[model samples]
Target chain A: MAYSGFRLIREALTGHKGWKPAWRDPEPQAHYDVVVVGGGGHGLATAHYLAKNFGKTRIAVLEKGWIGGGNVGRNTTIIRSNYLLPGNEPFYELSLQLWEGLEQDLNYNAMVSQRGIMNLFHTDAQRDAFRRRGNSMILHGSDAELLDREGVKREAPFLNFDNARFPIKGALMHRRGGTVRHDAVAWGYARSADRYGVDIIQNCEVTGFKIENGKIRGVETSRGTIGAEKVGVAVAGSSGKVMSYAGLRLPIESHVLQAFVSEGLKPMIPGVITFGAGHFYVSQSDKGGLVFGGDIDGYNTYAQRGNLPVVEDVCEGGMAIMPMIGRTRLLRMWGGIMDMSMDGSPIIDRTPIEGLYFNGGWCYGGFKATPASGLTFAHLLATGGPHATAEALRFDRFEKGLMIDEKGAGAQPNLH
Target chain B: MIIPHPLLGPRDAQEFVYLGDASLLDRPDWQHPEAGSAYYEYLYLRDNPAGVHRELWFHEQGDRSWLVVTRDTTTHEILSAELASQVALSKEPVR
Candidate 1:
């Protein structure tokens, strides 16, 4: 049912007996026109846009576990488009624009909070770099502002501004960037897609792909063998393992990126604040808990858990910027396997195998790019060409020496 | 995790830079006819084993020496650590 304020009141007056499930759990069909592997935000959003925008009817999204059980549910929930590269700025800007109207479009309360995001700069060189980045953002029709030390103090006064080693010089602020309710995004897309005649089958694990003579056919799953004319794989961290079943090796590595939340307290952080010298970023949730994370564990693994040293290192980075964080007790912590590409960017392209497509290598930017990723993947699947905004994200970019090295960290997955 | 360095005693894993799969050190000869494909396999293809693994770690903070570390990935247990230079020298055949 479409939710509304009047519906809430009516249900309350009627003793709440008219409510129904948000989305139905449907059984998978023996054959479909398109099958999307993995039911995270990207896959569900792909299905939603495919049915709503592309007018494709026979579609199914198969998930090994329940919805919102992957990286979509385990993230810091921050969103932004303040990128410096031409290949990246336009795509992420489109994602931010999609996020702006997401709640109204889905008729679900995804809590797209555009409070703001500030990247703190500590040195003169860093400030210049941020200045260039902010200029790039403005050039791409995205908002950005360079704030001085006093301006940063006005925005967030709790920061250790006068640290002897790494002083807080200024910040780059993007007013349109903020956090969202991560899991709600997956649920909203799933519900909308289901309403448009898309089947969402949960607990159906894809064991292998049924290929014939180097062309796509269907998939072998735990439930049974299902036939599909086209299949799209959007399994975030399992990209490497899943694509191997199709005899395709991915240029991706799976690493565990941990996130943490602290005990609830009074509202302190007004917006997201990222440390300039280290890999620490934090934002306060509506529940008053401080949600934060740092760099991925520097190794290749599919495990969704991390060790204690990285935890200590993340806390150190937090304490380096905001010393008061030492007092708050860590409530809980978890990990998500990141599909880290070589050049610290993502790939949304067709694989060598016909009828098989891949959408992964998100690293730390997956959660923010959900809507645009889905839309672009849908465009690619429908038209058999890359979307205008995602033309540069190709599988052959590395071989062609057109790598979108956003971080300039070279071809190292862990460094990204 | 604490990696017991052969020369520097116990060192935290944070100070070291991680490069996957110590097998990367064995570079294939460029003059070979299949060098192009071999280099591609060396750079992109990796055996991501879920159990025991031998990897490369650079001790950037303490000694600035690259170490070959053998460890169990599932348990995060360090089996052994050695200087990469020594390991490379040991791999060379005597004329």
Candidate 2:
């Protein structure tokens, strides 16, 4: 049913029971034109664009578990395009543009807020680096403003500006960067794709691939054999295992990253604020809990739980930036597996197999890149070529020594 | 996780820094004929299994020694930790 204000008001006046389930629960079909493995945000978005833009149908998204149960629902939900590299800046800028109009496009309230994000700088060298990054963002048609120490203080007065060790110097603010309701994104894209005749099959796990002598065919799953002409895999942390089913090895490792939330308090943070001296970023949720996270647990593990060392390390980083956060009672902590690529960047290109495409290696940035990742992956599946913006995220870049190492941390998954 | 160290016994997992797969110790020969593909596989490809995995961990905060630790990725259980230097000397060097 198409939803509108008039319909909502009419239902409210007359006993109010017109809402429907967001998407259909259809059984797995024997054959589909294209099959997307993984029903997280990126896979659903890919399916949405494939039908909406390329006019392709008979697509099915097979998820091992329920939708939005993976990193999509577990992420910090902050979105921004404040990138600094030629290969990455324009792509993320496009993602920011997509987030700007996402609610209307999906006909769902995804809550794409432009409350802004500020990256704090502590030292002269860090300030110089941020200025260069801000200029690069501005050059790519993104909004960036350089704010001095007084300016940052005016925005966030509770920060530890007079700390003895690390004094706040300046900040780079993006007025368009903010948080979105992460779960709503998954539902919004799934419903829109279902409207375009795409099937979202939940509780269906892909076990193996039926590749015949270097050509595409279908997949062997827990349900049964399903045929597909093209297959795209966007399983975030499971990228290694899923791609290995087709006899392909990826330059990726799985690691655990934890996120935390504190007890509810009155609104304190203006928007997303990241610490420059350490790996800490935080924002206040609508429910008043302080949402924050830091670096990945520095190891390779598929286990979705982290150790005490990282928890201590992240809290130390947070306390160094904002001292007031220490007094808040810690409420909950959870971990999500991250697909840490060798180059610290993502891959969105066709694999060595004829009709198999791969889109992963997002590290800790996948949540922000959902919309653009979906659009570009759909373009690659439909048109057999990388989108102009995503052309640099090819797999062979590592083989050719052309890695787009944004962090300049060469070949280290955990460091990236 | 606790690693039963070769020199020191039962050290906390937090004392070491993780450097990933143990296969990295077998760095490819730079002048070999198949060096191009060898280096590509060496740098990128991996048998990143969901079960048993042999990895490297540097005791940066402890003895500053590197160890090839065998562990399960699924459960994060440490099976063994051997000093990387001794392990390297014992193995047949790759050509």
Candidate 3:
């Protein structure tokens, strides 16, 4: 049912008996026109756009676990498009645009809080880099502002502004960037896709791809062998393992990136604040908990848990910037496997195998790029060509020496 | 995780830079006919085993020496560690 204020009052007056499930737990069919793997935000949103925008039916999204069980629910929920690269800026800017109208579009409360995001700069060189990045954002029709130490103090006074080692010199502010309720994005997309007759089959693990004559036909799953004319794999961290089942090794590495939340407190953080000298970035959740994270555990692994040293390191980075966080008790912490591509960017293109497609290598940027990744992926799957905004995100970019090395970290996945 | 360094007594894993799979040391000849595919496989494809794995770790903050570390990925247990230069010299010469 389409949710509305009138509907809420009617339901309240009628004892809420007319409520229904948001999405159906439909059984997997024997065949489908298209199959989208992984039911995280990207997968669900892909299916939603495929049905809504592309007018494709008989689509199914197969998930090994329940929706929002992956990085979708395990991220810091920050979103931004303040990128310096041409290949990245437009795509992420489109995601921010989609996020702006997401709630109204899906008729779901996603809590897209565009409170703003500030990247604190500590040194003169760092300030110049951010100035260039802010200029790039403005060039791409996105909002950005270069703020000095005084401006940063006005925005977030709790930071350790006078830290001897890494004093806050300035910041690059993107007013359109903020956080969203991560899981609600999955729920909203899943519900909308289901409304369009797209089957969402959970607990269906794809064991292998049923390819014959070097072309795709369907997939072999734990449930059964389901046939599909086209298959799209959007499994984030499992990209390497899943694609290997089809005898295709991706240019990706799986690493665990951990995130943390502290005990709830009164609202203190004005917006998301990223440490200049370190990897720490934090924002206050609507629930009053401080949601934060740092770098990925520097190893290749599919595990969803991190060790103590990284935890200590992340806390150190947090304390380096905002010393007040040193007193806060960490409520909970978890890790999500990152599909770290060599160039620190993502790939949204068709794979070498005919009728098979891949959408992964998101690293730390996956959650923020959900809407546009889905929209562009849907465009690719439907049209058999890369979307205009995602033309550079091809698997062959590395071989062609056209790597979109956003971080300029070279070809090292760990460094990215 | 604590990695027992060969030269240094013991060091936290945080102090070292992890580069997965010691097989990266086996660089194929760039003059080979299949060098393109060889470099592709060398740079991208990884074994990513769940059990015992021999990986490379650079002592970035300490001796600055690279170590060949064999550890259990499933349990994070360090089996052994050695100087990567020594391990490279001891390996079968590259073609």
Where does model 1 sit among the CAPRI classes? acceptable
Candidate 2 lDDT tens digits, A20-117: 78799999889999999999999999999999999998999999999999999989999999999999999999999999999888998898888899
Candidate 2 Cα misplacement greater than 4 A, ranges: A410-416
The sequence of per-residue lDDT tens digits that candidate 3 reaches over residues A1-416 is 99999999999999999999999988899999999999999999999999999999999999999999988998999999989999999999999999999999899999999999999998899999999999999999899999999999899988898889989998999999999999899999999999999999999999999998888999999899999999999998888888988888777777888999999999999899998467799999999999999988878776788888888888999988888877899999999888888888999999888999999999889999999999999999999999999999998887777888888752254433
Instruction: Name the lDDT value of residue A342 in candidate 2.
Output: 87
Per model, how many backbone clashes are there? 0, 0, 0
Which candidate number maximizes DockQ? 2
* Comparing 2 and 3 on TM-score, the stronger one: 2
Q: Score every model by TM-score.
A: 0.94, 0.98, 0.95
The 0-to-1 C-alpha lDDT of every candidate, in the order given, reads 0.89, 0.91, 0.90
- Per-candidate DockQ values are 0.40, 0.83, 0.50
Per-residue lDDT for A77 in model 2?
93
Per-residue lDDT tens digits for candidate 1, residues A1-416, read: 99899999999999999999888988888999999999999999999999988999999999999999988999999989988899999999999999999999899999999999999998999999999999999999999999999999999999999988889999999999999999999999999999999999999999999999888899999989999989999997888778878877766777888999999989999999998477799999999999999988878777789988889889999998899988899999998888878777889999888888889989889999999999999998887889999999888776666878888652364433
**Candidate numbers, best TM-score first, in rank order:** 2, 3, 1
**How far off is each candidate at the interface, as Cα RMSD in Å?**
2.3, 1.0, 2.1
Question: What count of clashes does model 1 give?
Answer: 0
Report the C-alpha displacement of residue A43, candidate 2, in angstroms.
0.1
Tell me the lDDT of model 2 at B77.
Answer: 90
